[model samples]
Target: MFFAGDIGGTKVNLALCEVHDGRITTQFLRRYSSAQFGSLSDVLVRYVKEIGPLSGKIEGTCFGVPGPVLNGRCHTVNLPWTPDSAEIARDLAQVVEAGPVQLINDLEATAYGIGLLQKSGQGLSILRAATGAIGHRANQALLAPGTGLGEAMLLWDGIRHVISPSEGGHADFGPQDEEQIELLRWLWPRHKHVSWEHVASGPALHRLYRFLKETGRETEPAELAEALAQPGVDASPVIAAMAIRGQYPICVRAFDLWLFFVGAEAGNLALKSLSLGGIFIGGGIIPNVLELFRRPAFFAGLDSKGRMSSVVAGMPVYGIVDPLTALYGAAFSAAHSHGVLHGFR
Candidate 1:
């Protein structure tokens, strides 16, 4: 048996999965708000008490943390506490016979989950002939937009799979038009280097809304949703809310802008790695507005590269709908670390 967790600032999900018949089976799963406890240890204690008997036979565990893990310790991006993998190992060791614990970036976990998806043929796939042109196997990149932008790539490392992390999302946001340039000018005073995270994240969305309000444009997704449902007053939510409602011009425009950047970024990644692998969009944001992504403009951006357009065109793109993707990646990491699965760790 193995234990794993997907820990974030707002919530933590803990689960136990038993490796049997070459498959990882979920034994138990639970969720808790991190703010409700002083430390992650408290949540772990409660989970163990409720689940019972996690001793002796369990091999190891892994954690997917939202923040960077340096020297085995992680500082939560939005929370007031820090987590040390060594300390966590010692504590859980008492219960599960003291095994090693692995810590990986949350984006790394998402990448692993993405690799798993490809292995199962449950993810997007590119034309084999097209991949042959690049002389690589099919795979995808994971772009997760949450508190900040997180990115990872699952690539065919010759023989097996490898999950590579990227700080590209923080690589700077280039404006595409007059409006975007104006937006960037508005944001420059507040931040030194504005990356995609500056305009593509949750807080960024709120910031845009605030900007609109400051400019005398009403910007409330909830209010827009309410208004659109009533019919006479035509208002739009964020890229997502409008997408979900089906058809609204302002919502459509908002989503178009969002997709243009996302696809262009994906194209850039695809070019850098020569990823014959597809691009998988993960995050709390895009899956909510996936319907809009299917629009013509979105795919156009992915194929917008002048000379390299043909190269990116062949790479498949997918939006991961599963919320537990990172958790699954944690489980995958644990299994691989134990040598239960090849190409893991």
Candidate 2:
């Protein structure tokens, strides 16, 4: 058995998986609120205790953390806790004596998971071009907008694909039109340097909603307004749901603008990486609001580059529907490190 986790700002998902002949099967899984736990080690300890003793049965462990990993430790970008792989290994040794404990950036894990899915013929249904030809050895990109924006790339290195983590989501936001310029100006006072993540993530939905409301672009319905005013309320999901249902004009517009920025940044990533293999969109938000992304405007923003429009136009794009992408990736990483799986290198 191998242990894997997808640790994020909002929640943490942990699982015990078994790999047989390069295929992974989850033996147990659980989700916990990250805010409720004092640290990742606490959550892992509780999980192991609850799962009963399996001393020396587990081989390796891997975690996909929502931050940059350095020297076996990660200071999470959005969370207050810092988890060290070596510390985790020490803690787990008390119960299972697991082998090498690895920590990787969450987006890197997502890219690896997508590569595994593609190899297994279980990747998201392709958004193919007219010619139905996707570049086999070209680089691939993964961009996810959740609590924060995440970016990663998979480079074809002659024999196999290699996952590389990036903090590109924090790069400066470039406005393409007059309206976006206005939005940038609106955001300028609040943030000295606005990034694509500031305007395109889950929190950005609430930010966009506030901008529209304060500017009197649209009147918020009384019911929705009350819900948003509630203490500790997260308006992002509510706004996205209303937009998808077409219940409010402001919510609809906010969702559209969010997608526009997401598409634009995705296009920018494509150009920067030459990701002809494909662009995979994954996140808690994308899988929920896929309908909004299917609109023509999303594609319009994606292919809006002046001179290089045709290049991106032919590139196939896909939305990852699977929520366990990072979890699977962590498992793959653990198994590969222990020489249990050879499919992913």
Q: Using lDDT as the measure, which candidate wins?
A: 2
lDDT of 1 at 165: 76
Q: What is the lDDT of candidate 1?
A: 0.70
Cα TM-score of candidate 1: 0.83
The residue-by-residue lDDT of candidate 1 on 189-234, one tens digit each, is 8887888877665556545544554555444455564654674442
Local distance difference test values of all predictions, in order:
0.70, 0.86
Candidate 2, 1-345: lDDT as tens digits: 889999988999999989877788787689999999898899998898888866437788899999999999997878888999989989887866677899999998898788778767774755544344555567888899999999998887867788889988899999999878888999999999999999888899999888888878878888888989999888999999999999999999888888888888888998888888888899877777876888776788788999999988878888887888899999999988988887544
Off by over 4 Å in 2: 128-132, 343-345
lDDT of candidate 1 at residue 240, scale 0 to 100:
57
RMSD of each: 4.6, 1.6
